[model samples]
Target chain A: MNGVFAKLRTGLAAAALASTALAGPVSAQQVKEFWHYLGAGGELEGVEGMMEVAKSKIDEEFTHRVVPGGSAGLRQQVQVSLMGGVPPMAYQVSAGLELNQLAQSGRLVPLTEAWEQINGDEIFPEGLIQVISYGDEKYGLPFAMSMLGNTWYNKGIFEELGLEVPTTWEEWDEVATTLEENGYVALTSGGGSAAWTIYQFYAALFDAAGADGYWEFVGGMMPLDDPRFVEAVDLFEAHFVKYFDDEWTGGVWSDGLDRLMAGEVAMYNMGDWASGYMRQRGWTPNEEYSFFPAPSLQNVTIFQSDVIVVLKGEETDLGMKFAAAAASPEAQQAFNAAKGSIAPSNEIDPSFYDPIAKMEYDKLVSEDAIVLPNLYVLMPSGFKEDLGNAFTRFGATKDRAAFDEELARLEEMRKEMYEAGEFGTF
Target chain B: MTTLNPLAAIPFRQRDRMTYFIFLMVPAVLYVAAYIYPTIETFRLSFFEWDGFSPPEYIGLENYWELLGEPRFRNAFFNNLKWLVFYLTLPTVTGLALALLLDAELRGSVVFRTIFFIPFTITTVAVASAWRWMYKPSNGVMTQFVEALGFDAPNWLGDPSINTYSIMGAALWAWSGFTFLIYFGGLRALPTELIEAARIDGAKFWTILFKIKLPLLWPSTIVVLGIAAVDSMKIFDLVWAMTQGGPYRSSSVLAVEMYETSFVMFKLGQGAAVAFVLLVVASIVVMPYIYHMTRQVDEVKE
Candidate 1:
């Protein structure tokens, strides 16, 4: 009986090997190439890891290529290629009204059917899903979600000063005062890069006032002349002028992180990806360093989601299949596990996350915080251009009344865009 | 020689004329195909609204209208003017002075000339990158030196008002060398008899330089000015590498603006319009100088 069993096992193994050999040679599945703007070391590693998994488990014959560059370079190159009529199969894009524009232009393949078939709506956060969906049709899949409105601080410094993490605007001011008095730079950030750092200040202000109301004002759904919006803007300007670095005007985001890591600064306002840098420098989360939502912002968190959009191509079916694979729970887990971001799909277990990441992930899942849409994404082309100019002027000039005037102009432009049916109503 | 008809008096045979036409036409046609055609195409594109990916929609002069209205474009245009004016004047003055000084018979003058020209040999990107590091507030050598001297270092690249100036300093460093070489060559060709006559007239050294040498060097100065003017008007790489037109739109020049509009903003028509505007502006500024210089050359020959 033992000899018979051994012979049967060997026969089955031989048959399996024979069948595998009879399978078509490699390069059977059409190759789908992608380009991305994820040039940071950790993000590149995460992408490579995902590629490895995809190659091993998914269509073995298919190939995945990644060309990485800085955001500006990638945006320029992608624009050139698309306008020249040679867009890649897949590319990294932010989810928002800009994406909606892309969809309307018919450059992107409508993934509504695939999304419905895969039940993507049920897995992704509703706000995120809504951001990527335009005209009641899905165009992309979310890959990573960021916790954008978080303050990262040196735990050692806070402990030395005997100050607890604050959870309110008043408390945050006190902490800033204490840190300043103690000969530490209270906060460090750069506004030179299109006023992105100012976003944190605005997010906090919006939180303190009211997130929904703030969005309505910025989106021009509410009157820009509203005194509440002015108050929020005033508060934002005050903190921006007060607690930021001495060279705030010249600062870059990477420089801020470097200062915090080098112990030259006390705290920084940044996204969760910052944790990856801290971890790389031999610091453990919640011990050497800790992060909390910007206390002054109330419960409003500014989040940005990374979404994958499939371009219209010859291999549309294969591209959709790969996109679906990218959206699968297994892919999300593998990607987010390496990426230090929350899996876009809610089905992934939060327990598998690192302790600090898990905390932010849990808060996002529970609170369902509002995702702030950048004006560039939400407004029409002309309006967005005008608004970008206005925002730059406002940030540089720091004249509140002038800023208000710009906001008014932006509101008028938004109204015109809406009237012209350029954008859907909120 | 036998008396020949006026038509036959021409130097070339009919066959030679055909060969000459072919020879000239080949290079001229190539130049037009490679350079002129693309420029014309880009100018044509300015009249059409296209994102570059899709087919362009004909929208005559709309891009130019929008560009004129856009405040950022205005700022960039003004910045380009500022760059051209300052860049042309400062470098030519410095280079001419240096070339005059080095033209004198002095010890180790060859070494001095080599040292002066060294910066120009370095790549523009490298020069920009090095300056960026030096201007860095945290780890820059200049910042550390300034801090050590018990002074606060201003954000060189951060301040909108001074950012272009800071980039100009780097550009001038690269440019002064080229001007020096041109002035050096001109000095070498100066008429010794004229200088001796000026000295005999009891003219002081300053008067000699201003009156005689300068007038003699006018041809070289014009050439240098023309090159520098064109270069400064089209300056892109150093500013892009250094400031990326940041700290608000303070450092933005027309070239950077054009690139951002065409590529970053994906407004190809607007970019094309900006490019054409830049071309016209550059032509307007340069043509008179070129004409005057050519006339000066003719006067010198006479």
Candidate 2:
């Protein structure tokens, strides 16, 4: 009876081995979670679709999910979540202190090995690649990029009012005046929406200061009291107070975007994300809406990118695949197409983008193009906030002295931040 | 009853001690873990300059000193004080009025009560969104109404001069329900004979409200004031969701400031300092009331 039992066990074991051989390699029990904030049909949605594109490489071993919140609210959630030990395997962060500080401090898992494995160097431009790395290590992979100075306009309104896309500040002002005189929204710049819109000061300053000071101003090496700074602020203050409706402070950036597309507003300068927003609202680019770099910003792209950060403990094999997949040209094209933003990968097919994105992309690679980093992204945490508050105060200023005072106030804060070495490696 | 209380036959000390500890153990452990530990940790954190992730450096009183010197801190502190004063008085008065209006127990009073309580039931995020629209200068209902009435509505959420009051109005709308419910409960618990006697003595509505009812509602008033004051000290979500402590940080309160410092700015030490200051301020406002209440409880027991 013992011999018979042993034979039976042997037979069963052999059968199990045969079944395993036929079934193929079993994937690990892992799911990579992505964190971003927004609704079902925007950036987050576009990313969710990219997970499908990634499946051929990673799906056998990994699944991806997204947790969402408001933009700033989501950033806070990622920080607190990391502190709680378990964090999103990958999360979207702006390309600056939030990413750099974490990446530099080694709290974030560097993605260099993954980038190398994926041949990211060949896919992304050297300059673009350099922007996403910090302290000689890459910590984030770019998913979506937007230039902040893309002033979107409703084509129908432009046609109705006989307005051409303004190529300079003077022309922009005249257009604003024309739109307002015709009883339409002129420009959307102020409070109540995303405060980062206030960073258009950098854009306005670019036009006001010429390219050299613009570079210096944004490099965090220039004084806020620069004549260019005052000129930009004065231009900003006057334009904001006069052209913007009293409601801009109550409505956020998206509000202006919506109003612009609906033909209620002629123009509003927003990040490249506006293309995604416009598309999400079912508007066709060029036909329904058209955009250009902000007036006076010659061949400039003040870009902000949403980069995927892999947390330290979350550097599992599957996690790396997810990060690599995020930066894949295929993923970038799909995401940019859906998100109405340009793909960060230079190798991506231009045909994958909409007309507006293609136009922006054209400028991005132009010989004259100067792709300045988004000012808000470069500033330390809450520094952009300080600038926004000062801008608001400046909006309420009646005279040059008060305007100069706000500038001095911002300069003092920047000086203190500089002393504290917040600029790090500017 | 004569069945000999066998359970009670045990010595009072033993029964009381075992039961007390067994019941209190879970709560005591939880309290220590959740509240006391964090409070102590925050106090300790206040001394060190640390971003949430990085190694903390001992900065001693530097964070506190900066808090004292910072203008934003002063603004937030003053704003909190404004919230405290406005909240303690306005909500209580309006709630009392609402309670009185609904206290008549007339037809549809229950409906009226439910309607008033609805704002309190909605989440703060939703409440802020709703009120933000109403306070919107361009197309908000309030703005349109004012314009219709032949006056320009000041930017309710924009102007620093009136933004705080505009927010206070929303807080009042959302919070008055809880106050009303508490006051109503207190009125329910009052001696009906006193009100009836006043009525018989020709006490009108105003007289009954001022003389008979309000005097009897002292304890409820104290509770409302305590809750309102403490709650106002921690008003963050509404202020953050609505204005983000902005239009220029004019409407910033201590709670919003603390959150921005700690999370947004990642200045853990400074944020902790703000939290400590807020705790100290809240305790200062609530302590005397607590002492008085404790004395009152002792008197009742006596």
Candidate 3:
């Protein structure tokens, strides 16, 4: 009688196991793990809200891990894990060569099918797709877009000085001179990270010269000795020397921001994302601070977006599904609204955006600004190192002649990279 | 009597010998496997070019050749040499002198000894961070103090020429305590009778220190010098936490350069190569001291 009862129990267990197997693919009801580098207080809260909403919509248990890192740290961790045959289900990556590197390493799953299934090809902006896609393969889904051409300022200081937002390079100089005359540091800049603050100068210059002309000269389509490139370098160096604070050489990006917030400096050129920091410090847009498109240098603004890539691993199918869900219009609206950025998916209502972000987005869309790939992403790693060295030299010397010499050397390096086909074929 | 049962007697001695060998060799074997094997692997890895992710490609001596030619690497190597010379000598000398002073029958000697050794109690990261803030150009305490004294405060970290020296000043503060402790113990262990005899022979204090104390403190000197040399060669934490080998890589040491090349640049092979070169240089500097010490130990035992 005991043997017969044991056999009955085993039969019931097997039937239950078979039933689960027949259910066909782990449903959205299963637990999913997500990794991100959003460790900042506001950003972390925003991500948690999005995750909560995602879990509510899907039948799955959501587990989100906040990876403590910046871009380099995240990349190193992800790359090491991926190469070692273990990778996170999903993680955020910058759109471009970072995505390309993952794809080449066979650590990224193609998301073309996922995009089609979700109708992302229609909802997402073509420009954003172009940025995140490699060849015929899609490795990431864009969630938020950042505007890189905004110059934030202390509104109180500007109003007291009766300085209007400058629209051209000459006017910018006048404003800087006026501010300096009034005992305010004209501009706050930091060279600690080399490329972070310098990108503003590079983008402004690229815009002024016309996209084609800038690329032909600075991008090594033409010789480094081109007079136009030298002129641009001189202009960039002159502005850097004339306007930036004396202590800028040792200051980090956050320090410059702190100086601006403390009213020690009148203005700083940075990305739209910098507003998040200001908001966190209890400064509201159009009240304590205001931002405008950077003046002069051809009025061109370069844009970029942050993307989420599904790392290929044991749970790749689940990872791809999670990334797709994260990229959906509903998810984009929830995430970008809380995080203070524009959604890459055009389906989201503009009314959901904050006043500052809406204004930046409208301007960017209407002007059809050029999206210049970050130099670090566009150039080979070695070339990026050389470029950083050159920038360091330029910052230290504050010499137009030296800047031009460095630009010439950079041109040579870019040419070598182009010939080697290091930057992927356009 | 042994011939009656030589085999039986041999087994007993063999058992004792086996136990002795285990006692002596186990700890050393574990230590070498844990430490020395990894170090040798790091050297071997120097010959390959890898990004730590991709499969490592054998690049022969290309990395070494490039390192020899690269201006940044050369600057770091030369700076390391400067650190070894200045950092090793200045702190050791000052520490020995302080130790000698304390060894004398001075009032509150214990308090003075504790006070002098306080800097070593602070962690390297904390010391470096404090010093970095102090050396800040505009608002730093050092800058403020200098300006109060009616002098301009040069950019201690920003200026490439002075950055390494500034970092060294911070290092010296943390290191002097350690050397002082070693020397203090050495001075305390000296035979009192010999010193008393030298004083009775009309030897002056300075003459006694040079003629008697220093010679007897040879063992301590060798140990201190060896430790200081090795520590200076492998210096990383303070430099990393303070300047990050920056102000245009002026403060870069071999360790920092190796890290940047391997992790930041994703060039692991080159990083390993730099590390190996650093090891070779360190061995060249330290092996002779180690050999001499070993020989001295043998002589003392004999």
Predictions: Cα RMSD each: 13.7, 10.6, 9.9
Every candidate's DockQ is 0.19, 0.22, 0.15
Return the clash pairs for model 2, or none.
A193-A252
TM-score of chain B alone in model 1 = 0.90
TM-score, candidate 2, is: 0.88
Write model 3 residue lDDT over B1-302, tens digit each, in one string. Answer: 34676456568889789789989898889887798766766776678765544445677888989788777899889888988997669899988988988888699999999988999999999998899789877788988999999999877876778888888889888888888999999999999999999999999999999999999998888888998889878988887777777756788899989877877777777888888889889999899789988998899999
Native contacts kept, each candidate: 0.42, 0.42, 0.21
Where does candidate 3 clash, by residue pair? A29-A59, A208-A297, A208-A298, B50-B269
Tens-digit per-residue lDDT, A219-244, candidate 1: 55655556775676666666654676
**lDDT (tens digit, per residue) of candidate 1 on B27-129:** 9999987988668777877987776445567899999998887778899999998888987799999899889999986789999899889899999999998
What Cα-based lDDT does every candidate model obtain? 0.74, 0.76, 0.73
Per-residue alpha-carbon lDDT of model 3 for A1-426, expressed as tens digits?
999999978965775454333221222222247777877775677677667666666675557777675766776776555434445778888776556655665556799888887787777655456656777988888777776757889998899999998887788889899999998888866545545545656644564465666444333365556666556566666665567666765545666677788887898877777787888788988888888767652334455677878765566777777777777777878888888877777677788877788777666555555545444454456666666666665666666676676667667777777786655432
- Which residue window of length 10 is worst by lDDT in model 1 chain A? A22-31
Error of 2 at A91 (Å): 3.2
The DockQ-based order of candidates, best leading, equals 2, 1, 3
The docking category that best describes candidate 3 is incorrect
